[model samples]
Target: MSEYSQNLRASYEAVWGTYQQFTERNEALLRDILVEGEDYYAIEARTKDLDSFEAKVDLPEKEQKYKDIAEVTDLSGLRIICYLDEDATRVCEQLGELYDIDQEHSVNKNEQLDPDQFGYRSRHFVVAFPADRAALKENARFVGLRAEIQVRTILQHAWAAIDWKLRYKNSAEVPQHLRRRVFRVSALLELADDEFSSLSVSVAHLRDEYERKVDAGDLSIAIDRESIDIFIEKDVDLEALVALAEDIGYSIAPNHPNARDPYGGVISTASLAGMSTIDEVRTKIAEVVAKKEPRLRQVFEAWREPDRPPRLVVSKAGLARLAIVLSVEVPQAVALVEKLPFGPKLQSALLDVLRNG
Candidate 1:
C-alpha cells in the first residue's frame, strides 16, 4: 500500500527471478551425480518483500541504519529438503561445488547439545552468486547479497516448518514454556533420525551379506544340496563352481577353509594348495565342506592330523608339498590358496613340519 512497500515487492521479484535461474542450472547438474536409487527432490527459492523484511528490523538503530529498507530483500531465503540425512550431505557437497559459499554451519544439536536441548538438525550455507555469472550485474542488488541455503532431512524440515509456524508470534519473543515444548519435540525428531539411520545400516549390512553369498556360491546348499553334489561330481574347481552357482542365484562362501563366518567368504588362506583362481579357491573350499556329512568328517580328520593341523602354513617346502598334493602349479596355487579364511602362514608352517617329518 505504501510507496516503500511497493518498491520492496518489485526488488524481491527481481531477486526471485535470479534465484530461479541459479537453482534451475544447479538442479540439472545435481541429477547427473545422484545415485540411481536415491531420491532427488525439489529446490525452492524466495525473497522477502518490505513487510517481511521490515519485520526483522526491531532495534531503533537497525531502523535508522537503513532508510531505504524496501530495497533490501532476502530476509528469509532458499531451502533444500532431502529424503535422508545422507542425501542432505550429498546435496550440500554438490551445492558447495556449484556456488560461491559465504558461510557454512551445521546445527546437529542432537549430537552436541545436552540431553535437555536435543531436537531438529540441519546444515545451512549462505552463498553469493559467482562473480563471473552473467546475471550477476543485472541482479546487482543480489550480487554481494548472500542467500541462505538450508539443507535438512525431510523429518527435520517437517519439524522446522511446524516450529516456525507455532513456536513464536515474533522471532524476538519465544516464551519459556513454548521453548521447553520445542526442545521436547526436537528430542523426538532426533530419535526418529537415529532409528532411520539404524535401519539404513541394517539394510546395507544385509545387502553386503547377500552379495557375498551370491559371489561365494553356497546359496543352494541349504535348499538344494543337489547343486553342490552335482558340482562336486563334475570335479569343478571350487571357485569356478561357485561363480556358476552365483550366476544362477545360489549363495556361496569364500575360499578360506577356516572361515568363521561362512557367508563372509575367504579373504586369505594358509595352504596355497589346490586353488588357482578366486573362483577355484571359493568353490573348492565350499566343495570340501558343503556335504558336511561323510566328506566333511573325512576332510576334517585329515586336516586335524598332528602334522596337518587343518590350517595352511606357508613355507617353501610346505608350499611345494601342497602344490604337489593338490596337483596345481606353485604360483597359481599360492595366489588363490593364500586368500583362504584361515591363517595361511600357520598352514604353510605345519605343512613344512609334515614334509620334514
Candidate 2:
C-alpha cells in the first residue's frame, strides 16, 4: 500500500472502535423511533474496516481525495430497510428530526434519476448527532463523526442487491442488447413497490371504514378478518357470552392459543353453522345465550382437563365455538371442534365428551 493509504489505514484503526460505538448508539435511537409502530425489514449498523475504508477511498467516482479518515462520511453506516416506499420516506423525515443532516451531501436517488434512466433508489442521509445530544458526555465522542444512513423499501433493497451482483451499477452500464431487459426488470420491481404502498393505504382506509361501520352497529358488512376484528371489539352479544362464561364460574382467556386467529375461528364457526353475515352470527349468539346458557356452560366444562380441577377456563374463541355448537347440529359442531386450534389429543378427548353427552 502507498504511504498515504497506510497512514490513513492506521488512523482508521484508531477510531474504528469509536465509529462502531457511534453506529451502535445511532441504531438504538433509530430503533426507538421505529418502535413507535413502524414495521421494518431490518436495522443494520457497521463501522467500515480497514479494507472497506481503503476501497471506498480508492473508488474512481470519488470527487476528491480524503486527506484524513474522518473526512469519509460513511466510516459508520446504518441501513433501515422498510416494507413500503412510504415507510422509507416517513423514516427519513423522522431521522432528520433526530440528527443534524448534511443536506448538501445527502440525496434521494429516486429524485436524482432522469426520466429515462433506471437505477437502485434509496434515501441517503449524511448525519451526525444533533448538538443537544452531542453536548452530553456520553455522546461527546460522536460529536464530529458523521454516518450515512440509507433508507429503502424491501423491493428497492432487492433490486440494489441483485443489480450489484449483475455488476451493472446503472442501466447505462449494461450491454446495449441487454439494457432493455435490465430496465424492464428494474421497472417492474419499482412498480411493484409503488403498488404495495398504494395497497397498504387502501387496506388501512378499508379497515378504518370497517371500524366505523361496525361501531355504528352496521352488521351488513360481510364477515372478514378486519370486519370480524371490529365486530369482536364492539358486538354486545359476544360480550354477553363472555359474561355468561364468567357467571358460570369459568374464566374467559383472551390470550389463549385459539385466540391466535380469533377472527378466523369466528369465521369458521359461523360458516360451519350456516351463518352468513355478522348480523346472523350475532343473532345466533344471542339466541343460543338466551335459551341454552346451561348447555353452553356444559360444553365449556367438557373442555376441561380430566386431570385438573373442576373449575373451567376457556378462550374467547373457545366460548364462541361452544355457542356456535349449540346453534348447529351435532355433526357440524363436531366438525368445528375438529378444526379447533387445540391439538389432536385434546380434540379426541373433547370428541369423547361430546359423543357421551
Candidate 3:
C-alpha cells in the first residue's frame, strides 16, 4: 500500500464513528423535513464502508478524481427517493432551508439528461448540519461533516438500479443498436414520469373546481367526498338541525363533530336509495330531519361522550345516508351495510352506532 493509502486509512479510522454519527444525526434531521405519509418513496442514509472507500481512492489516475480522500463528498450519503419527478424539487427546497448546501460540487443530474441520453438522473446536494442543529449538545459531534443527498423519482431510481446491475459505466459501452434501444427506453420512462405529474395536477384541479361549484350551490353537481367536505365545512344544514336539537333541548352545537362520510361512504347506499345528484342529497336530508328529527340529532349526539360538548357540526350528508337506510320503502340499512368498504366486524360496529343511537 502507498504511504498515501496508509495516511488515508488512518484518518478515516480515527473518525469512523463520527462519520457514522453523521449518518445517524442527519437521518433524524432529514426525516423532520419530510411531509407525512407517502410523499416520497423512501428516506435513507448510509456511511460508505471502508472497502468501498478504498476502491474509490485506488482507481487509476484518469478514472479516479479524488486528489485526497477528504475530497470525496459522499462518505456519508443520505438518499431521498420520491414518487414523482416534481417531488424532487419540493424536497430540495425543504432541504435547502434545513442545511448548508455545497452547490459548487453538487450536481442536478435530471437537468443534464436530454431525451436521448442514457438514464442516470438525480439531484445530488452536499449538505452539512445547520447551525441550530449542531449547537444542540447531542448533535454537536457531527457539526462539520458533509453528506450527499440524492433525490429522484421512483422511475428514475428504477433506471439507476438496473444500470448498476448491468455495470455499464457509459452509454458508449453498449453496441450502437442496443444504445439506440436504451435511448428509446429512457425517453418512454421520461414520458411516463411526465404523465404521472400531469394526472396528479389534473385530478387536483378537477377536485378544486368541484369544490367551487358546490360552494356556489350548484345542486346539479354530483355528491362526492371532496364536495361533501365543503358542505360539512359550511354547516350547510345547520339551521334545520339546530332547530330540531333545540326542540329536544339537546345541546349540539357550535362544536358538533361531523362524520367523514356515508354521505360519501354510502355512495352505494345513496345509489341504492335512489339518491345521486347533490340536489337529491339535500332532499333526502330534509326527509330524514322530518321523520328522524331528534333521533337524527341523537345519532350525531352519539358521536360525543360523557364530558365533551355536542358536535353540532354533523355531516348533513350523513343524514342523507341515514335517511336512505332508515327509509321504510327501500332495502333496509342492515342489508346495504354489507356493501360498505369495510369488514363485517366494522360494518356490525357501524350498524350498532346507528341502531342504538
Cα lDDT tens digits for candidate 2, 1-357: 456666778889888888899989988888887852365779888888889876666666642488777778888899999999878888888887898999988999989978666758998999988889999999988889999999998888898899778978765678999989988998899999989988999989999998887778788877777777777777888898888778776777664443446556668777767777878878878987787456655555666666866656666666666677667767777877876545454465557656676
Q: After superposition, how far is residue 102 of candidate 1 from its true place, in Å?
A: 0.4
Compute each candidate's TM-score over C-alphas: 0.47, 0.88, 0.76
Residue lDDT tens for model 1, 227-276: 22233333334444334333433333333544333222222232334233
Ranking by TM-score: 2, 3, 1
- Whole-model lDDT, model 1: 0.48
Candidate with best lDDT: 2
Looking at model 2, the pairs that clash are none
Per-residue lDDT, model 3, residue 320, is: 43
Which scores greater on TM-score, model 1 or model 3?
3
Candidate 1 accuracy as TM-score: 0.47
**Is candidate 1 or 2 superior in lDDT?**
2
- Which sections of candidate 2 miss by over 4 Å? 60-64, 248-262, 305-319, 344-349
Per-residue lDDT of 101 in model 3: 89
Off by over 4 Å in 3: 1-3, 61-68, 114-116, 223-225, 228-235, 238-264, 272-274, 293-324, 327-332, 341-346, 349-357
Per-model CA lDDT versus the true structure: 0.48, 0.78, 0.68
